[model samples]
Target: MVRKANEDSLRAQAPVFLVADGMGGHARGDAASQTVVRVFEEHIESGAPSTPERILDAIHSSNDAVRDLSTAGDVGTAVSGTTLAGIAFVDAGADSGCQWMVFNVGDSRVYSWEGDRLHQVTVDHSAVQEMVDAGLLDPQHAESHPERNVITRAIGADEYVDADVWLLPAAKHQAFLICSDGLTKELDDDQIARLLASHTGEDGPSTADVLVEAALGNGGHDNVSVVVVRAMIS
Candidate 1:
């Protein structure tokens, strides 16, 4: 709650729900995140499903756009990077039909909400996450790890960005939460699950609103961004 500005940017348009967290230290993070949103907005159409190829192209375009923010003298010394996590409704092949293309570039995350339980869909690209994957650190200690904020990959950190992706069936009922690390830094999975269980889409505030307020209440020192995507196929 004490940050000078909210560098996080998001796109909640249909077919795409994303959260981009700008790298804060010594970086043009706000512009980096905004670049990502703008690139996606320009590349993908609204209120309609997209193809996997188009989404991938948008990811690559986002990296190029964010990288453009750092030019000339700033190339080697300056940093313009951001973490991206989101889900896109895409048309898979004839066999797979329509599905959710869940993708991630850095430490931001996408979680599937089912039966009031949260299941992380995208793996983080952070140092602590690497350690946890290597069995060098316990999952329970990852949040408190000193290198939790140190990400290994970002949109503009490298010339080419390879997003980790997954495919989920276009089920009858599906819900997903795309968020920046700011929310995770403040609240744990149990707290988020409890909040979602009590959330009624038609009543009171939205799920994203409640979650953001809860994170801010927990001494949110970083920018918090959350996007809730729901699909009900009757």
Candidate 2:
């Protein structure tokens, strides 16, 4: 475990779990990620209801903050950007259980695990991902593609950022994972599913540790962060 500051930021408060992977190449990267997390922390701590609009507002504010930081003379970076992926709770419907509001910008991801399968909830805004979606590149080949790291969308990278959003039923025994590219870069979907299945009934922190360790074991070339949220049966 290195003692250096991490550019990746995570928020794991119940009903709101997220990961931000910074992309400015040094301290600027740290600033980008920290700015986003700080805003989320404040939003969560404010005791505000987790409404879809409120969450989107917080994300917009984070984008402004990151862009502000990039332009600030002190940060020394002309442009700082980051990938954000997260899940928050919102009303499903009257008398219905709450739903997971999943969103993403750039390559970070949100995964839903249920009954021995893992499904990706948010699409990656990266070049490789686009190729895969367009059927020009095979999923297996995309992993080793040279342009795999190039993301088409990110907060602070542009004036207006559009995040892909989804509202899903938060069923009992279901687990959701929000993570940066670090973990996925090291391990594929199959590996992630197996590892997650291994810790189905364990605590969040424990599952996180195992996932991080697995990434580091396979050459942790980038900063990695993960947040696991589970819906339990009472």
Candidate 3:
């Protein structure tokens, strides 16, 4: 846990919530994450119609900021980087219910909590994840893998970054979670699911606090952040 300064950034709006986890041990990580969040906030606050393309554009702008900041003098040495993950509302055309536009970069994640179960919605862009996908690593063992923290894609790592995006129909009685790898490192999917289910119907902020507490109890090896949002028909 970073006391004096934190590298995690959160942005919340109805149907639009994001979590950016700055890479640890990197220079200007906090600034990198802040830049990412600021770009999204500006887009949202601009009063422009929200669309999937606009969200993607905002992420590109964020990437530009992170890339620029990472190469600035003292901050360039370590190369600042951060994981971006979140959901945005997407209109599904006339007479169709809205859908969720989910995107992710690096190891931070987005999860769907439905039917009393937790389903990871975003694929992690990390070395360990690649190993798991290739059948070279066991999911259980991957947790402690030396390359677990080696993210393959990050917001500020290069000139361009592509995020994995998914669109899912909006559904009631479902909850969405956006969190940093810190939370996942301390709690497995089952544990997180159980904890979230136990707090069903509770407010998002309360559940978020519980999650942070759980991570801390399990040895918070890194900065932890969580955002819990329940889907509802407005």
- Clash counts for all predictions: 1, 0, 0
Q: Report clash pairs, candidate 3.
A: none
lDDT of each: 0.91, 0.81, 0.85
Give candidate 3's TM-score. 0.91
Per-model TM-score versus the true fold: 0.97, 0.88, 0.91
Residue 23 of model 3, lDDT score:
83
lDDT string, candidate 1, 153-198, tens digits: 9999888998998988899999999999999999999999998889
For model 2, the local distance difference test gives 0.81
After superposition, candidate 2 runs with Cα above 4 Å error: 1-5, 24-27, 45-49, 72-77, 92-97, 201-205
Ranking by lDDT: 1, 3, 2
Candidate 2, 127-165: lDDT as tens digits: 998899899999989879999888888888766879888
lDDT of 3 by residue, 113-196 (tens): 885878999999999999999999999899899998899999988778888999888776568999998899999998998889
lDDT of 1 at 53: 95
lDDT: which is higher, 1 or 2?
A: 1
List ranges where model 3 is wrong by over 4 Å: 1-4, 46-49, 72-77, 95-97, 201-205
Q: Considering TM-score, which of the candidate structures 1 and 3 is the better prediction for this target?
A: 1
Candidate 3, residue 131: lDDT: 95
- Candidate 3 residue 58 C-alpha distance from true site, Å: 0.7
Best by TM-score: 1
**Which ten-residue region of model 3 has the weakest summed lDDT?**
42-51
